[model samples]
Target: MFHPDRPGPTRTNLAIRTDPDQPSDTDPPSDPDRPSDPDPPSVVMRTDPDRPNEDLIKYGWPEDIWFHVDKLSSAHVYLRLPKGKSIEDIPPEVLVDCAQLVKNNSIQGCKMNNINVVYTPWANLKKTGDMDVGQIGFFRQKEVKVVAVEKKVNEVVNRLEKTKVERFPDLAAEKESRDREERNEKKAQLQDQKKKEKEEQRMRKEMEELKSYTALMKGENMTTNEVRTQNINQYILINN
Candidate 1:
């Protein structure tokens, strides 16, 4: 059943499908305008469709070289190197692969240009989600010139894409939701504790007043039974 402001199972019915065997470079309905690459290279780019503005650049040690289209674009590509390979030893095949991967993901009519390659250590790569809410807050966007690649980052991205999708909302989203729910629960718990404390304090004050009244009656000529009768009558009057 449908309810106002609340979405139904219709939203869940929407599915995102990707072919495991098909390379991410398979153009989205090939544009007749794109020039054919005689020998394509390998490169990596983002697999998500929501955010068109984020990019991940691999830097430092090249164990995890990630590359992507620079701009408000969705292209995440990674270069896998032999365990000890340095960035300087990256082959022409790798460069071509990177270029083809970028060209395939971009707008069909994008002209060829020298794309920027950040030669920093792989440790410098920022793993922020392409769909993250505040990714634009921390990083400045720069014009990235795509370095020509000898291979495509499409295959690596395709393999990891499945795992990423199966894990819903990504890690950041899940953590944020859990933290918020926990905070709300904690606040409610504290309020209950405070209420119980107030009730206890009120009970103690009433008991102390009764003790004082009994001490005063002990000093008077009145008997204990007479004092008890007077206290019961006072209580009834106050309650009524």
Candidate 2:
């Protein structure tokens, strides 16, 4: 259950987290070879980075790099691997950062002076049979002995995340603009209806006036019929 005092998560707020397993805001684009998509995947991070392996499996992609503390229990570190780049192409600085993320995930590593970290492409890893949500089995992976955890894994990941999120256009703003256009159209339709009603009313009044004029003429003819018939020649001569 969510706490009442806690603020709800949103795109902007969800972007913030203490763990490196969460994709970095500064992550580079995966599609460096071609023009990026106009609308790409939006930035979505799990609120809890407690179990990184599970998060990686759920949110991580085949191109992503997986990192863990060598023998100690650790959270999974997912590096957004660049497209068309081999494992050797990864920058040394970025590797050091990933090592730091792995160390941070382990309770023992954080206390020790240094810890060894292992990494492999997510594509190379597979989940064991009926394993827990966050658990995974790695057949083989590259290992690096990182003495000082200069945590930059999150930074590189952040760069890649920015690239992905930028592709998604702001839908809320678009929805508002669409709503305004609809309102304007409805208002114009209503005004046009009012104008048409007024025109119709005017036509009805004109027809009534014409009918009244005919009736008045008929009544006058009826009232004067006897006088006119009695002296038709006199009446015509007088009128002439």
Candidate 3:
């Protein structure tokens, strides 16, 4: 039943499996003599190999982009998208970041002059027949071309690019901190307003008392001695 002319299943939306035995760009070489790498870029440490796809399903929407190096070995890379955002809505910076990741994670990618990264929505990535655990297929047939040097240049430009994963929880935390600070400032303003009101009331009360004493002293029924005694007693009371 072996017909050579039929061609094996037409390989549509096909992907190559990254053999576990083979070392990847993601990990450092086993040789102790070599200097150890200071960064881990491709590794998504929060998720295990058993369900690396979970991050895609959980945080990434179906509309989110998935990329692989064309005709070369590459790590499965997904650019996360918000639930309602479409591929068109993806920012240019994110696209640039994903392109760098795809190029860097490919086998001998840095050595190559240039590499083309084909990407598609997760929805377009299908598992029609029985594929390996990490292997998947893409139907969208879209590609973003990148020069290998660009990845190196970007990494050099921003050192944080090494560990920069898709999720940016730090940005969210900073925004939350700003909001809390603003709320605290508003509360402090309210306290200041209350204090000002109290001070105003105290000043008005002193002014009214001074007016009453002046009116009593100005009355014609009081003699000069009586006025003097009244003024001394009023001054003492005010001081007290």
TM-score of each: 0.32, 0.41, 0.40
Ranking under TM-score, best-scoring first? 2, 3, 1
Poorest 10 consecutive residues by lDDT, candidate 1: 6-15
How many clashes does each candidate structure show, in the order listed? 45, 12, 0
In angstroms, how far off is 110's CA in candidate 2? 0.9
Candidate 1, residue 32: Cα displacement in angstroms equals: 26
Error of 3 at 152 (Å): 3.3
Encode model 1's per-residue lDDT on 1-240: one tens digit a residue: 001121111111101112222234433343233343433223333333233322222121235354544442423344545455755555664455444544444442134354443322345444454524213221222422236433345553343333222212232454466567778999999999999999999999999999999899776756767889999999999999
**Residue 171 lDDT in candidate 2:** 36
lDDT of 3 at 7: 20
lDDT for position 221 in model 3: 51
- Model 2, range 1-240, lDDT digits (tens) per residue? 001112222222122122224335564424343333232222222222343324345434545566666666655555655445545656665555456545644666656754566667767676665665555665553433223553435554444344433223243564466567778999999999999999999999999999999999999999899777879888788999
Instruction: Give the poorly placed runs of model 2, Cα more than 4 Å off.
Output: 1-49, 53-55, 140-240
Q: How do the residues 148-228 of candidate 3 rate in per-residue lDDT, one tens digit apiece?
A: 333444542242233333332332354467567778998999999999999999999999999998998777456787889
RMSD of each: 19.3, 17.9, 15.2
Among all windows of 10 consecutive residues in model 2, the one with the lowest summed lDDT is 1-10
Q: If both were scored by lDDT, which would come out higher, candidate 2 or candidate 3?
A: 2
Residue 181, model 3: Cα distance from true site in angstroms = 29
